[model samples]
Target: MTIHPPDRRDFARSVPVRLWDESFAADPLRHYQALRNQGPVGWGELAPGVPAYVVTDRRAALDVLHDEETFSHDPRAWEATVPDDSPVLGMMRWRPNALFADGAAHVRYRTTLIDVFDLVEPHDLRGRVHRAVRLLVGRIGPRGEADLVGDFAEPLMALVFNDLFGLPESQGDRLHSGVGKMMEGGDRATVGEAEYAQYVLDLIAAKTERRGDDLPSRLLDHPAGLTREEVTWQVFLTLGAGYGPTANLLSNTLSRILGNPLYYSTLTDGARPVMDAVVEVLHHETPLANYGIYYVRRPVAFHGVWLREAVPVVVSYGALGILAEREATERRHPNDASHLSWGAGAHACPVKQHTLLLVTEAIERLTQWLPDLDPVVPRDRLTWRPGPFHRSLTALPVRFSPRSPASEPSGVRS
Candidate 1:
């Protein structure tokens, strides 16, 4: 028998105005309690009759994101609702990359690139992300107020991705742009799937010509290696998956610190001070809020619901259903950390360590370069950018003093 909760819209209607509204763009975790009050499986939809559990329970979320046999991460669960040629389709399809593959195939693609994600070691990138953060900080340092989103977050992503993947200097910017475009919306309109496809095809050809020890070239040489099209597909995956989430993560942390004074002292007072804060922010407000699906694939019961296949199950980033334990108050400590920002199970972010290392590096550098780092644009006046898959802040204005020596590029932004 299928179990479901009461109507969330109706229940949420009784919630305080500010609390309800905040549930939309910003942290919806506060509503998690209320949603859970109704039952595990709640009635509501990003679409109609889309019965889903407004999961606020830590254990439940792990059970769902971690279990693939009952639930699918293919992103194809919504084939019935979304259009066939949607950019999200780029995500659902077993395109030019490996994430779309499952079981053994998924294992192969992940194993091939495991080294890239593994070797990143945040300490390794400290100097690199530090240099980028320092340079961007300098740009807005004189201003005394600037958006952390652009000045700090975006640039950090470029530097981290570039350094980790070891992309060539000349092509790095374009790759970044292409990925950003895809993240903002559909790959069809943004990546111009066919056009970007050709472009990536050409890019692989050129990179293959040199065949150096760089990331792409190295992947090409790996056994059970992929073709150029396959290579480009994976490139698409990196950009689509990694880019905006990191940007959003940085911006969200700043927003939290700015709004909640408790965060500043509480989060930063640790051996690895910045690490706890970053994880907390990511835990509280996942950049990728929910993983979309059209069907359950099998008769699987989650959070008390026996969801049938083809039912659009929105598996959120575990923010709603998951819990952040009190012990996580300590840095590098997850004993109390029940947060599920990264999806779980076989589909859990294979690049988990790499992404955190990048985030940790950015935070550490921010602390070092701008100990007094604070946003310039008045907090309430700031506007945030919106994306369906990733929650993003369009701009974050801030200012800092005690600048560093890193130089900024011409026409640079803070």
Candidate 2:
């Protein structure tokens, strides 16, 4: 299992592949394969002229994820090198939150999040998700056709999250618009980042004046004694992290279920749980595909590659899924949960159970309300949003039998 470093001269000479473009968005596997061809660790550009080493091999990725000593989560060293207007900066920029910290600071911030999130019981979360799904279906059910990504997945996350964060339901659109633009990582990214910052600021300010049973208020009350500024960043990280990936996961899972007639039948007939489809998407096509970003403090040799100081070493979860599939001699069951989609080691997703509950429940509720829902276009023909960090769809249009809101079941009508 030992992987020795490749020849430094040849590795240094290899050209970095571009990841933040239409080609990568349209056919990510093709670009992943191109990176794999270079070696376990391949050079790639996250955006125009932004070069970094993208780790495509599972062993190399695991090595990077587990070895915090060699690879640091802090990107300040590299951040200073990038332009102020870099599209990727929104994602990679250092914050006081757990995602960008290392050592004791990481532990302090991470503990506060875990402690607060642990208070959310499964039943409570499921109820919130069901309520959001009901509201969404009521709006779209009467139309007979809707973009699931826009009309359902995105809004569902916003509604549930807004409720959990103690914001008015009307403010969900702000959370959705800001996070969506920022995750897309382009000219609008800066605007998205600013909008999201203001949204978090407002939430903190409101909670400061009067606390509530929401995440921000909980963080403020935690024993960590985090200052107002610290609380704001934590809320920013959690909301942005929770919303974008969960929305994408729900949309991606729906696309898989609706795209296959047999699968849809199994789901509607109760032969399979919606969770099976969700797990299948996690294994084959994860939402936050290549966002496990790490940086080295000094030039170091790792798993057959030379990692330059402060350069990003991205773990391609999408590529890792493909590689795992190819390397497997036996067929993997649909419910297998071995994928690295939630990431690994220290920075692994803290709210994975919450995320799973939200997505599965949302899907189950939607399918139950509209059993004959069908994709307007084939899944293969659908377009993806352009970005290096996320695997998100631009839209998922679908058609179903129309029903008036008044005719729907009593509790769900908007």
User: Which candidate leads the pack in lDDT?
Assistant: 2
User: lDDT by residue for model 1 over 103-160, one digit each (tens)?
Assistant: 6777877777775455455556666676667656667666666667766687667766
Candidate maximizing TM-score: 2
Candidate 1 — worst ten consecutive residues by lDDT sum?
12-21
Candidate RMSDs in order: 6.2, 2.1
Candidate 1 vs. true structure, TM-score: 0.75
For residue 83, what is the lDDT in candidate 1? Answer: 58
How well does candidate 2 match the true structure in TM-score terms?
0.96
Give the lowest summed-lDDT range of ten residues in model 2. 405-414
- Candidate 2 colliding pairs: 5-304
Native-vs-model 1 lDDT?
A: 0.56
Residue 148 shift from truth in candidate 2, angstroms: 0.7
Off by over 4 Å in 2: 1-6, 9-13, 331-334, 408-414
Evaluated at residue 48, the lDDT of candidate 2 is: 85
Candidate lDDT values, in order: 0.56, 0.86
